[model samples]
Structures are given as structure tokens and as C-alpha cells.
Target: MGIFRFSDMPLKKKITLIAVVSSSVSLLMACLVFILSESLTFPRVMRQNLSNLAQIIGDNSTAALSFNDSRTAQGLLDTLKANPHILSACLYDLKGQVFARYARPDAPQYWPAVVWEEKSEFSGGSVRIFQPVLSGGDRVGTLYLESDTREMQLRMMDYTLVTVVVGVLAFLISLLVASRLQQRVTGPLQQVVDRMKDIAKGEGDLTKRLEVTGKDEIGEVAEAFNTFVGKLQGVEDMKLDLISVVSHQLKTPVAEINGFIENMMMGLTGELNPKQKTYLDEMRAIGRENYRLITDLLSASKIDRGVVTVDLKPVSTKEVVGLAIRDYEVPLARKGLSLELEGVWEGGMLYADRDKLVEALRNLINNAIKCTDKGSITVRALTEGDMGVIEVADTGIGMDAETMGRLFTKNRVLGKEAHRSGAGLGLYITKNFMKQQNGDITVTSEKGRGTCFKLAVPRFKPGEGGRL
Candidate 1:
């Protein structure tokens, strides 16, 4: 298994991460303060020990110098050496030279200083004490004493150990608290995620709301998600209702026209003359328009219900375009317009539904012929990138931005002129059918210039490749 990245982590992990990082920072700050306090206290305790030793050495030095006896001074120094705290002792003359020195024999060569301005070196824990000798206010020698600080060192060590133990206990307690906090934060988020997954799988019930407890950001998120789901459900219901009403309204007119056309064609009515036959032909044409409208309504209804299915196959784009042109040739000639086919290929194939592709192409052509006064409509196909592009360009009265925006919307009439001739479901049906086939349609137009509709489909085998 691969290691998870931070971005891929769930809400629970993110909450846990926040808790851990915050606790770690707090613990570090506490440790820093403890170390600083210990460092400050250690130096103060050592200085206090030095001051006490200095006082004791000064009293002994005063008695030795007053009696003017070297034996007494030496005896006092020997007694000081026997003490566990004392490390070394020295006596200096009036000229600051070491006249006499008595140190512990087992002590290190580098003994602690007493009167020098700089500190001295000693083994283990050490303190330095200085004493000046005076007799009748006359210049005399100085006494130096060195002492060990093992007791103070042991005290500091004990304090440090206690601090470490307390810190560890605090960290463990914080871990428990963090876990509980993470649970509280992630619980609602998990519910929201599960509900979203249900909605994506088509279970769009808006009443499935999360139980909001606290007024925190997580609760707010849950409330917002509930609102969003509710709005989505309402919109879906509205679309379904619209499709139902539009279908009923369109089907009635289409069924009536179909019945009328059937009756006339079967001669169920009276016989017709040449003029009457022409009128009947026009009525048949209107019936065909109504049939196209009904078909478009059905297609739009299916698309809205999300029930449209595509049958993908490796079909030749050239063959479909040729068939579309063949279907519209007679209509184009009758409407005083010309149809031009360009870039015909023997094996320009695409992966799409051949029947749907032909239907989409015919819609675009019919739309062009309806809008154009007297101009040529061109259908061209070529390969660009990894897709086959079919373009239908017409030198017709092109649409403005307002019309173009509603061109692919269901039942949206572009203008009164186009509506008087036919309904405006051609482009809408074309767009939906293209989408069902894993393709897309795009358009470009200007008011006085022209309009071009381009269909893009994934290309099939170009040279010597296998079937899709």
C-alpha cells in the first residue's frame, strides 16, 4: 500500500493532526521555561555556597594571622582539608605569591582558586572562597579555600528528574484529551460526507440532515450542506414537472396532426384537385413539422430524466454526413437554398452512434435552411488533434448574443421570425444528442455575419488501427 499524503487525509486525520501539533508546541514551550529556571537557580545556589565558605575561611585566617603562628595556620588548614566540602587551601604573602599551599593529596592538579580574578578548574562539583589576612592593620598574606558542590549538583539533578516525569505525565493526559476532541469534530463531518455520497448515488432526500450540536465551524458546515441538498432536490423536482407538462402539451397537437394527415392520405375525406393536392401537400409538410417537434420533446424529456443511453460504435463520419445531406437535399432545393458538401473522406470514422449523429447533423442543416433567405449552407468534416470535427456553416441571418444564449435551451424561441416558421428545439435536441454520444457541439455567430455549428467527436481508427 502507498503512504497517504496530507491532502488525501480525511477530516478525522486532519483534526488529529491539529491537536497533536498544538500540544507539541505547548510542551516545547513549557520545557524551555523549566530549563531556563533551572539554569538560573543553579548559578545562584553555587554563589551562595561560595559566600558561606568565604566567611568561614576569613574567621580562621584572622585567628592564625593575629597569633603570628605558622603552626596554628597549618593546623587550621589541615582540619579544613579533612572536611568533605573542602578541596584545597593555600596561603599567599604580601606580594601575592603562593608562600604556602596545603591541598588534598588525592585532588586534581588543577585546584580551585580563591583570590584570583579569573575562575579556577576543579574536579567534580566545586566552589571557590577567598580570605584576606590582616594583623594590626599591616599588609599580610591571603588565605584561599576550595570546596566541593556535590550536594547542590545532586539537588539539581533530582529537580530535573521531577520535571521530566511531570512533563511525560502531562503529554499523556493531553493525548487523551486530543483524541476526544478529534472525535467530537470529525463525527459530524463524517455524517455530511456519507450523505453527500448518497446524493451522488441518486438518493437525493433533503430531509436527511446531520444532527448539529455545537455552534462551531463544523456545525455550520453541516447546516450549509443540508441547505444545498434541499435546494438541489427542489430544482430536480421542478425540472421533472416541467418535462411532464411540456410533453403533454406537445404530444396532443402532434397526435392530432398525424391523424389528420393519415385520413387525407387514405382518402377518407373527399377527393382533391391539383390545387387541393398542393394544399394537402402543405398540410402534410406541417404534419411533418409537428412530428419533428414531438420527437424533440421526447428527446428532451429523456435527457431530463437521465434515461438516454448511447450505443457507441465505430462508424464513418463521412457516411453519416452524406446521409444527412441526402435527407435534406430536396428540402433545400424547395426552399431556394443550396447545400454544399466538402472534405468527404472514404474512411473518416468516429466512435459515436451513427443514427444520432445523422439526426444531429440534419437538425443543424434544417435550422440553417429555415433562417437563411437565399444562401449556401456548407457541411465540412476534418481531423483536429485526436477528434473528428464536423462544421455546418451557413450564410444566413445570424443570431445575436441574446439569441445564441438561448439557442440550446429547451423550448426557447430565438426570435419571432424563426418561431413563425418552426419551433426552436432543433439546436437543443442536437446538443443533447451530441452529449449522449460522448461528443459536443459549439457555435459561433454574429448578428449580420453568419453562424457556424461545430460538432466534435473522438476519432476512431485513422490509418491502420483496430476498431473502437
Candidate 2:
């Protein structure tokens, strides 16, 4: 078993522990103060009381001392029996000689001959007090009192008991209050976290809100989250609506242009000259690029609206790769760029929307073509684990750290030239399409080296999609 340290403790447990420790420390300090005050003040108070009693005794015994009567002096000192704290008492003459002494009846008479001291003090858990006896307003004798401190011990014990009770009560009360306080602070934050997770997991509902319990910091956090999500929802909605309208409008023109170019290439109206045919082919390429862009934009709009219609079917990885090569071969050949085919996709059956996956593959290829200028591009498809992986690698001008970091961010393209010439939505749309179809895309690149984009989708099993 691993040892549990305070750093590894969970939040609520940490909260509870802090409260308990604080209460314990406060109680411990109070206990120390009480003990210290008693240690000093208790002895002083006992000494003062003993000194007063001894003075009264000496005053009453003044005549006895003057008449040289031991019996009367002893009787005056014996009155100390009334105080349980007074262990023993002694009467002395003006010459400082012991005249009489008294002790508790049951207590051993351990009285020793004493000399006069100028101070009242505590020793051996007891206090000694001394007073002067007088006759005819002249110093006649001195009387001394010894206190046992048993009564003081009893009183201190009672004080200690009360302090312990209060400390325990304080600790228990703090735990309850602290637990409640911790709940109040963490509750709304937890709700915000759960709600954000729900949206990320595809619920995507921005209307849900955290209840505002107060106008404190926690409530402010909830309010900030709601406002931020509201803004994000607005932006996303506007983006999709604009894309849908623009793409739909552009699709018609691209279709018409492609139709006219195909007709000219097919010689539907009349035979064309060689130079005219070549220019028509170039126009066809341009038309195809436009058509593909419009299609991607429309698909992205559908995807953003969460209204994408996916038709997952068994499709061979080789066939998909072939389609991608066919799409890019003309452009690559024009640029004198070589396209290499690598490792066969043996367990080739993959479940995906054939058109959508093809579009994603094409974007990766096109993106590579944009970044890479001279070197060959490599296309590889292979089965790894439970997924089929398609890799499009380019040996061209690689990307910098900043470009790579924001590569798939919405409306952020890799290169400034590409941003000016093209909409910066290809990689972002490609990633979204892959995610909606339960796939993933990853990119690895190094500056001045090359870039590789990988698309991993689940391999199809027999009858995986049933009918649809």
C-alpha cells in the first residue's frame, strides 16, 4: 500500500482536515495560556491568603507571647486546622525562636526547625507565609504558615476538565460548519464542469445554466461561464448559416462551369483544336477545385449544425487511396512532384461515409501540396490495432512551431500565402468530419523537414452496419 500524504489528499478531505487542524491549534494555545497563568497566579493568591491568616493568628497570640504562656500561643496557632490547605503552622518569639507549632491531626508531624526569611514563596507544590506579632505597638514575635496545595490542585483539575470539554465541542462544531462551507464553494463549480463535459460529449446544448445561489465569487464564475458559452453558441450559429448560404450559392455556378467544360472536352458541340483542348483541361482543373471547395464548405456547415447524415459502409482502403491519387495526380505532375505509395492496407475494410472520408483525405493531400513545393508526397494506408490508418506525408517546406500549433484552429491556416489565397477552414473541417464519424486525425511535422497527416478510422467487420 502507498503511504497517503497531505498533498495527495482530495479537496473535500483537505478542507475538513484544515478546519480540524485550525480548531485543534486554537484549543491547544488556550490550554497553554491557562496552565501558564495558573502556574504563576495560583501560587501568588495562595501565598497572600496564608499570610493574612498567619497575621490574624499572631495578633491574637501577642498577649500569650508577652506573658510567657506556651499554651495560649499554641492554641492561637492551632486555629490553622480550619484550613485544609494549611499543612502546619509555627509561632516564634521576638528573639526568632520557635515557641509553638501545629499540624493536621492525621498528617505526620514533619515540622523542621525554620529560620526567618523575608519572602513569601511556593516550594514543593506548597506556599509558606510569614507575619509579625506585636505588643504595645512593638515587634514582639513572628508567625509562619505552610500550605499543602491539595485544594489548589483540585481547583486546577476542574479548570482543565472544562477546557478539554470546550475544546472538543469547538472541534466538532468547526467540522460541521467547515464541511457545509466547502460544499457551498465547490457545488457550483462542479456543476459548470459537468455541463461543459456534457457539451463536449455531443449534447452541445448551450441553453443549460448553473443556478446562481449568491452574488459572491462562485456565483460570478457561473455567470461568466454562461456569458462565454452564449457568445460561442452565437458565433457557431452565424458561421454555419453563412457557410450554408455561401456554399449553396457557389455550388450552382461551379456545377454549371464544370458542365460546360465537360461538354467542350467531350466535343458535344464540335471538335476542338489541341491548344484549345489543353486550356479546357486547365479550366476543368480549376472548376474541379472550386466544386470541391464548395462541397467541403457545405459539409462543414452541416457538420457544425450537428445535422450531418453519415452513411457508413464497407469500403476498401486501396480504393479510397486510389481515388485520392487520381484527384491529385494532375496537379502533382504539373509541379513535377512525385507521389509514392507505401505499405499495403491488408485488413482494408473500413466503416465510413465514402464521400466524406474521401473529402477529408483530399484536404490532407491538398494541404500537403500547399506546404510542400518540391519533394515527393507519400500515401500509405495500413491496419494498426482495431483501426485503419491513412497517412499523407509531404517532403516540402515544413511548418514552424507557431503554424503547427494553430494548424487546425478554426479560420487559421498554416501559411500567410495560403490564408490570402484560400479559406482557412480545410484542416478544421477535416478534423470535425473525422470526429463525427468516430475517427481521428493527427499531424506530426518538423520545421524544414516534412509533415505527415494520419487519419485513423475503425476497420469494418462482416455485417457491421447491418442494413444502413
Worst 10 residues of 1 by lDDT: 111-120
lDDT of 2 by residue, 245-278 (tens): 9999999989998999999999996999999999
All models, RMSD in angstroms? 11.7, 8.7
List the global CA lDDT of all models: 0.75, 0.80
lDDT of 1 by residue, 9-66 (tens): 8767777777777887787788778777877787667766665665565466665655
Candidate 1 positional error at 253, Å: 8.5
Backbone clashes under 3 angstroms, per model? 0, 0
Q: Model 2 off-target regions past 4 Å?
A: 1-68, 75-183, 186-228, 257-291, 342-347, 400-406, 417-421, 463-468
Question: Which residue runs of candidate 1 sit more than 4 Å off their true CA positions?
Answer: 1-270, 345-347, 411-413, 417-423, 462-468
What local lDDT score does residue 454 receive in model 2, on the 0 to 100 scale? 93
